[model samples]
Target: MGIGDAQVSAEDLETVTQQLGRTPRGTRAIASRCPSGHPNVVQTDPRLPDGTPFPTLYYLTCPKLNSLVSTLESGGLMKEQTERLATDEELAAAYLRAHESYLAERDAIESLGTQVTAGGMPGRVKCLHVHVAHALAKGPGVNPMGDEALALLKAQELWPAGDCAETAAG
Candidate 1:
């Protein structure tokens, strides 16, 4: 469809074309309006051009709504894009990976020192610090890796230190 057609709304054409294209690569091109006038998008997947499987449905603001959606999609793509939420299995797997890594590092540090205190091994501590910082820095958005990292950090009580904590806090 062309950009301009009084009978066809740009939003409708965009939605239908996206369904046919089977690619939701870009942000939603439509917005939703509630009874109270709250704008949002109700994502629905009709089918692909070849009738293949599609991703889950989700509502989002239109990219035309001041380019917010486009900005988010672009930023996410640049930063190893992630969804807003994680499944339980994903969360569990991330937690297990982080926990295993932390344990292995802790063991290595303990081996280096005859007596291991809370601050005995600065190397392992530093690693933990970095890991936690990385997780938290992923933003307040819901994510499996971030959640797992945060959980591991809290379990170990390896609070942030020095510039890392300052950066995370800021």
Candidate 2:
């Protein structure tokens, strides 16, 4: 019932399973939560029990948030973000750091034997879900793209236009 804690409560596990519509694998910790205490982001192991390499260290587990993020992705946000990476040197550098940070975190758990980080990081914005999950898990100022995506979503209980946040929290 805590961030970075090894023990994940059965309730949280069950909630995540319901959110994903499948039994989750490699879940390690509850990375972040909605205002109502629902687990919105989960920290996972580098590899699954079946020996599958799962590079996603932070997994978004809220169905409502997932739907919103999917909406953003469908809106061609990924393409625009990727294009911005080519010109926004500062953003690109920060994204590379985010990628490195993700790799380090995953490596600390178990090396997947590849530097391939999640979310198409350091190069392109392939997945808004991953970036948003990363931002929620690590907090602000860590992932620039994530922060931007979060802003675009206006996803925070403190924000005025928190459609996703309200959906997840409520």
Candidate 3:
């Protein structure tokens, strides 16, 4: 879509409504879409309609992808990443870059006043869902931990490769 078309579309809103099972709050645009043309990642406003601070910039909406990431989280992937972050200086440095990038993206719209990025970035690893969403939205090489989690999911065949998006009629 072009810059003008970047604004949320009716189709995108409907798809996100279905993906979230409720009207999404603070949704600005569809950040990424599934193979079936359904919204998987969304770009949300820094603040909600009620003027509440919403730090999660990119939200993951696809149920299939959410389930896969949840499985990875339950399997101790987050703990593994946390451990890796403590031991691997290069990886930690890369994660710091990811944190900076996330802050830059969010502050471009509105400053959140703290370098603390979503999904426990910079010094720690938490919430694979958020990390995965960031990776999916920003693409690979942006978040090393997220990229690693996605790679693990793909190796386990848990990543969504086919179109599993739910249709309106379904």
Candidate 4:
């Protein structure tokens, strides 16, 4: 995802803290917001302030989104997507590009010196959360599988609506 302005206010941090139920570390900016104007995807620093490596550059922080993704996982969407990847040459190429793009974005902040990208990218579909976060933050067309999952969510009428993230703050 594009980093955008990379601005994180104290209020924004507070909202994220509430959403995650913990202090967020190395939060670079709010990469994407839900339609209700709350952060859903956050752009994070590749490495934590304490020098611990954090490979996840874009984090999905909305509790509702998390719950929906978890449900999707339990429904075996990952396996379906992975199976499609094996046979869909166009999709496989896009997924590989997504992997490379993820690595490049993280490297721009700080080189982790590892090819490992989130959500079992490049060859496998592992975590819908990562892919969803990527698609949400970066928008459609960047990650093929992510786009597919998002389309599924839309079809199921499960796309997060309302200020669910703000509700966590309450």
Name the lDDT of candidate 1: 0.33
Q: Which lDDT tens digits does candidate 3 get at residues 1-170?
A: 21123689888888788888999999887787776667788888999999999989989999889988888889888888889888989999999999999999899999979787788887787788889888888889999977988898788776666555445355
TM-score of 4: 0.92
* CA shift of 63, model 1, Å: 3.3
* Candidate 2: tens digits of C-alpha lDDT, residues 1-170: 34666689998899899889999998889998876677889998888999888998989888777877888799898999899899989888989999999999889878989989999988888888999899989999988877887787675433323543455435
Identify the leading candidate in terms of TM-score: 4
| Decoy 1 TM-score against native | 0.24
Count steric clashes of candidate 4. Answer: 0
What clash pairs does model 3 have? Answer: none
RMSD of 2: 3.0
lDDT pick, better of 2 and 4: 4
Ranking by lDDT: 4, 2, 3, 1
> Highest lDDT among the candidates is held by which one?
4
Q: Distance (Å) between predicted and true CA of 65, model 4?
A: 0.7
Give TM per candidate. 0.24, 0.89, 0.91, 0.92
lDDT of 2 at 131: 93
Tens-digit lDDT track of model 1 for 1-170:
11112243455555544534443432222323222222223332322345543231223322232132233334452133123122345544554454444344334423322222221121122122223222332323322343444454346544232322333224
Span of 10 residues, lowest total lDDT, candidate 1:
117-126
Sort order, TM-score high to low:
4, 3, 2, 1
Clashing pairs in 4: none
